[model samples]
Target: MAQTAGVKPMAIAGRVALERERCLGMTDAERAWRKQWLKDQVLAANEPVHVEEYWKERINPIRRFYRKPLDVLFDKLTPMLGASRAADYRVITGKLGLIAVGVMAIHYYFKYHGNDWTKKGGWRVTRSKPMVLPGQPGFPYKSERSKDSDYADRGYSKSSLFDGK
Candidate 1:
């Protein structure tokens, strides 16, 4: 006999399918307990998820470190800032934290990954050594063009590549 107002057969089937993976390698007793725990966790619509005893025991102590200080801080601020202003400050603090994380991520990218897009080796000009043009003082007229020439070094040589060096 089917109960129209209670848990459906499909819900049980879905839960079994989901839990099947988790149930693998578990002892028979442990599997049974897990299934029972999951069934108990399933509740009617509009109810918040119930934290299990194990998780609550582990998290409570860690949560207290921030929870107590924040509670006291907000309580003290509520009179001076008012409830709305205090809530705004809380939202602003969260946004500032997100901005800080974004900045750090960008800094990490530029520091570690920026070289991939950048040109390599001797691309920048040195201001200390100004160029000496021909017909001006310190110009080199004795220089013969070769592989060591600026033109050849820049890959603009007119020589045919098929010709052996």
Candidate 2:
């Protein structure tokens, strides 16, 4: 038998078609059952090997679908500025600027005005007094016996106990 040029492998095509068919043929009951099964599998096992395997199997396709476009964009942009300069530009302009803007915006919005949506949702603004340590001036420190004081009186330092020594 002569093979046609530009034709995909039969097994590969068949597998794709089978997958499509299986996806298409999934009834509501089957989907619900699978969802319940997945939930059960996730809940029953602290470390879900099967779910992890399923996710791992999905990774390549998900990566290919999502990362491929970003990779293409990167490849296209890289040469215009050269790789090193492009990478540096991306880090400084893209990552750093995003973080800086996010921090500044959050600081400005929260500091100047309280969150509008939260206020609209009937949230009341409450201020908590700064917790002052013992012997600290200005704010009055409570003399209540706390866990720290109890631990300190036992002749064991808080740092030492935290270090497991």
Which is the leading candidate under lDDT?
A: 1
Cand. 2 Cα-lDDT: 0.58
User: What is candidate 1's lDDT per residue for 90-133, written digit by digit as tens?
Assistant: 66876787799999998877565543213354333322445678
Clashes of each: 0, 0
Alpha-carbon runs more than 4 Å astray in model 1: 1-72, 115-165
Candidate 1, 35: how far from true, in Å? 48
Output the number of the TM-score-best candidate: 1
Q: Write the per-residue lDDT of candidate 2 for residues 1-165, one digit (tens) a residue.
A: 447576765542232235666566777766676567556545544453347567668678766675455456666899898988766765565566669989999777766665333244432355455788767785575444555545324223433444543
Model 2 off-target regions past 4 Å?
1-82, 111-119, 122-126, 138-165
lDDT (C-alpha, whole model) for all candidates: 0.62, 0.58
